[model samples]
Target: MAGVSLYSSPSFSVLCLAQKQKLHFSVSGDNQNVPFLSRSLASLRLNSSANPLPVCKPFVTRFSDSGSSVAESEPDSSVIKSELQSETLVSEPVKQEPKREELFAVVMVGSRQYIVFPGRFIYTQRLKGANVKDKIILNKVLLVGSKTSTWIGKPVVTNAAVHAVVEDQLLDDKVIVFKYKKKKHYRRKIGHRQPITRLRILSIAGYEDYPAVALSDIEPIK
Candidate 1:
């Protein structure tokens, strides 16, 4: 029939299995010895065998490569213990370097001004009869700054004094001055060096509102 299918025949599976690899298919049957039917039958019989594959085996997986590498590269237990000990060091806050106070004082000495700091020296115009290591009080504080506060004076603060010790008495380098009058043919040459004193600031004291240190309940022997 025109609507007939080859797969509907009884030998479909057998022929498929036989020719699965080659992908070739054909069929024939006797129908009153027709020439076309005879040729089809001969072709079908010529390529009837199949080459289908057999059933597959079960699946399996293993990680021996990764496991073997890890095993081979492991450190000794003692090394591991030491590393663990190092990592377990006591945790503490980061200790930063101590910050210096930004304290300074502006004091006047011999008609000159200076900004002095604790334990630092400043040069001033020569002080009469001042000797090295002689203690002196600077009573002309114009301004004073502490770590957290500043005090200013209208002209000069009262009672604020800086204690200092004379460190040196020295002269500045000589400076030369030349005066000339070309038409009058007159010339004057002069050289001068000024005297200066080096004083090391010891401390600044005044109404700083510092915490009062408690006096001993009993006075100590002088």
Candidate 2:
């Protein structure tokens, strides 16, 4: 007699083989806390030999975060300083001229000395001993300094020059009268007309020609 077969069909034999070969999953003591990756670890391995690794960008820290480190990382501070210095060196210092002092001179007229200041007006006057309608000459001068005397040498006054006419005229008003309080007394009056002369001052000489009057030479008039 033939022994009865436990699996009669070929499909039942395949199913029993699959059940015997089924793999049982279990956690190892060392891998209990480890995560399971969906892809195999071998597939995640980088093929460095076939393809070059990507270079990582360096992190840039702001200057406000770390002052000393940021300053150290800055490039070529000395070159910037040198360039600024070179720019300043190219410019030249400005030169200035020395200022000169101004001098002045005047002509002495009558009892007064009329020194012409800057923008002063010039005119003429009559002298003490001038004749009627006669022109008078005046040579009074004040040398401001040594440089202004050269202009004083020429005849500063001229006769019949139109500039010799005195633009302003002046007269004395004081008069003397005689009277007698008596019977048959007569009263008389007398007046005098003072003689006047005209004078004109020419140009002021250079400072060098200025007359030097000593202290003893300047005597007070009585």
Candidate 3:
């Protein structure tokens, strides 16, 4: 503002002269000089198109290898079916047969308890009124057991009996009882043999009279 001067530029002189002459611009309807502004816009569009901005290329994903991997991992239907058939074939030979039943019982005969098995002879206290080869039926069964189950009675199993044949009547070894007194000079000796009966078990029956199976009919474990 200190060193500035007026009437220095040509544009300032033209503005002063136009103002003095009272000159002005007026736009009419339908007919106008709008192409001058349109030409400037068109020139701007041409400049933008002639020198375009840099374009970036997008990265692409290839699925060909992934598809191949999926195919390789998938199991074949035919191979799965063949494997099941092979398992069935291998299992067939290992199957086994049903096992036979085993049965026995604990019977009270006279004053002693005896574990009786079919076809086996067991010695018991001397039985009265029983002769050789005579089949004797005992009803004092305490417990009856089988391969799968067992039944125990409160005192004795009712209706369950053991049938045995008398094989022999014998006496046991002698047991000596000696009495002695030192300084008294008194001595005595006594010997005795207990009577016993050897009986062969025939069968054992349950409440329903189902006969017991012997060991000879039972099959051995594989």
Best by TM-score: 1
lDDT of model 3 at position 112: 82
List the candidate 2 regions with Cα displacement exceeding 4 Å: 1-76, 106-143, 146-205, 212-222
lDDT values, one for every candidate: 0.77, 0.48, 0.78
Over the stretch 1-222, how does candidate 2's per-residue lDDT look in tens digits?
A: 133465576788899877666521332332454556433434555555557776544333443457777667886878889999998999889889864434345556666665553323443344544444443333454334323222332334222111233323344444676676677677777774443333333333333433444445566999
Task: Indicate the worst ten consecutive residues by lDDT in candidate 1.
Answer: 209-218
Q: Cα miss at 74, model 3 (Å)? A: 66
Q: How well does model 2 score by local distance difference test?
A: 0.48
lDDT of 3 at 47: 84
Tens digit of lDDT per residue, candidate 3, span 1-222?
A: 533545576788899988766533322221265646543665788888998865543222236666778889998999989999998888756568765447778988767888988878998889888899998898999888887556676677778998889999999889998999999999989999999899999898864453444567578999
Which residue runs of candidate 1 sit more than 4 Å off their true CA positions? 1-97, 209-222
lDDT of 1 by residue, 101-138 (tens): 67788998877889999888888999998898999998
How does residue 41 of candidate 3 score in lDDT? Answer: 62
Minimum summed lDDT over a 10-residue window in model 3 is located at 22-31
Alpha-carbon RMSD of each model: 16.8, 19.3, 20.4
